[model samples]
Target: MWVFWALLAAISAALVIVLTKAGLKNIDSSLAFAIQSVMILVITWGVVFFQGNFHEWRAIEKNAWVFLIAAGVFTTLSTLFSYKALSQGPASVVVTLERSSLVIAIILSVIFLKEKLTWQVIVGGSVMIAGAVLISLSNSRD
Candidate 1:
C-alpha cells in the first residue's frame, strides 16, 4: 500500500511540473504560485479535518513545527527561484535542475539528519548534478 501511494505521488508530482511549465507560458508566475499555495493549503487542511487529525496539531512537537515552518519557507523560496529559472531557460533544462532537489535533499539529510555518506550516494548525486548541467548545455547548443 505504501509503495502504491509512493508511486502515485511520484506520478502526480511529474504531472504537476509539466503542467506548471505549460501554465507559466501564459501567466505571471508569482500569481500562479500564490493561487497554487492557497489551493494546496486548503486541500491539505481539508484532508486533515476529514481524517479527524486537525486536533492532532495541538499534539505536534515544537521541534516538528519548527522544522515544518522552515520547510514551508524553503519551499516558497525554491518555487520562486524555479519559476525564475523556467522563465529564463528552456523548460527541459529548467525542469531537470528543479528535479535535482533530490540531490540537494540527500546532502541536507547528511548534514542535518546525520545520515551516513555512502559512496553510492555521492556517485549517484554527482551523476544527477552532471545530468542537470548537461541538459542546460544541450539547451544552449540547440
Candidate 2:
C-alpha cells in the first residue's frame, strides 16, 4: 500500500513538473509558486478537515511542531527553487536534477534518523546522481 502511494506521488510530481513548466512561460516563477502554494494550503487543510483530524493539531508536541515547521520552511525553499529552475530550463533536465535530492535524503536519513544503509541504497543513489549529471550535461550541449 505504501509502495502504491509512493508510486502515485511520483507520477503526480512528474505531472507537476511539466504543468508548472508550461504555466511559468508567461509569469514569474515566484508568483507561479505562490499561486500553487495557496492551492496546496487549501487542499491539505481541506483533507484534515474532511478527515476530522483538525483537532489533532492541538495534540502535537512542541518538538514535533518545531520539526514540522522546519520541514515546511525547507519545502517552501525547495519548491521555489524548483519553480525557478523549471522556468529557466528544460523540464526534463530540471526534474532530473531536482529528483537527485533523493541521494541527499538517503544520506540524511542514515545520519540523522539513524537508518540502516544497504548496498542497494548506495548503488541506487550513485546511479541516480550520475543520471542527473548526465541529463544536465546533455542539456547544456543542446
Candidate 3:
C-alpha cells in the first residue's frame, strides 16, 4: 500500500515539476509557489471536511501538532527552493538535484531516529549522490 502511494507521489511530483516550470516561465518563483500553497491549503482542508475527518483533527496530540507544524515550515522552505531551482534550470536536472535530499534524510534518520544503515543503503545513497553530481557537472560542460 505504501509503495503504491509512493509511486503515485513520484508521478505527481514529476507532473508538478513540468507544470510548475511552464507556469513559472514569466513569474517569480516565490509568487508561483505562494499561489500553489493557497490551493493546496484549501484542497487539503476541503478533503478533510468531506471525509468527516475534520473532527479527528482535534484528537491529534500536542507532540504530533508540533511535528506537523515544523514539517509544514520545512516543506514551505524546501518547496520555495525547488521552485527557484525549477525556474532557473531544466526540470529534469533540477529534480535530480532535489532528489539529493533523500541522502540527507537518510543521514538524519540514522542520527536522530536511531535508524540503522546497512552497507547496501550507504552504497545506494552514494550512487544517487554521484548520479546527481555527474548530471550537474555534465550540464556545466555544455
Candidate 4:
C-alpha cells in the first residue's frame, strides 16, 4: 500500500513539474507559487473536512504541530525555489536536480533521526546524486 502511494506521489510530482513549467510562462514564479499554494491549502483542508478528518487536528500533539509547521516552512521554501528553477530551466533537468533531495533526506535521517545506514542506502544515495549531477550538467556545452 505504501509503495502504491509512493508511486502515485511520484506520478503526481512529475505532472506538477510539467504543468507548473507550462503555467509559469511570462509569470512571476513567486506569485505563481502563491496561487498554487492557496489551491493546495484549500483542497487539502476541503478533503480533510469531507473525510471527517478535521476532528483529528484537535488530537494532534503540540510537538507534532511544531514539527509539521517546521516541515511546512521547509516545503514552502523548497517549492518556491523549485518553481523558480522550473521557470528558468528545462523541466527534465530541474526536476531531476530537485528530486535529488532524496539523498539529503537519507543523510539527514541517518544523522538527526538516528536511523541506521546500510550499504544499500549509502550506495543508492550516491548513485542518485551522481545521476542528478549528470542531469544538471547536460546542456552545458562550450
- Tens-place lDDT digits, model 1, residues 19-127: 7878888788888788788989999998988998787888999999999999899989998888767766777888898889999899999999999999999999999
- Give the Cα lDDT of each candidate: 0.86, 0.94, 0.94, 0.92
Specify the poorest-scoring 10-residue window by lDDT in model 2: 50-59
lDDT tens digits, residues 3-47, model 3? Answer: 999999999998999999999978999999999989999999999
Kindly report which residue stretches of model 2 are placed more than 4 angstroms away from their true locations once superposed. Answer: none
What tens-digit string does per-residue lDDT give for candidate 4 at 14-73? 999999999999999999999998999899999988898787888999999999999999
Clashes of 3: 0
Report the error of model 3 at residue 39, Å.
Answer: 1.7
Q: Is candidate 1 or candidate 2 better by lDDT?
A: 2
Error of model 4, residue 62, in angstroms: 1.2
Off by over 4 Å in 4: none
For candidate 3, give the lDDT of residue 23. 98
| Residues 1-142, model 2: lDDT tens digits | 9999999999999899989999998899999999998999999999989998888888999999999999999999999999999999899999999998999999999999999999999999999999999999988999
Residue ranges of candidate 1 with Cα displaced over 4 Å: none
- Sliding window of 10 residues with minimal summed lDDT for model 3: 133-142
lDDT of 1: 0.86
Flag clash pairs in model 3. Answer: none
lDDT of 4 at 96: 89
Better of 1 and 3 by lDDT: 3
Instruction: Please tell me which model should have the higher TM-score, number 2 or number 4.
Output: 2
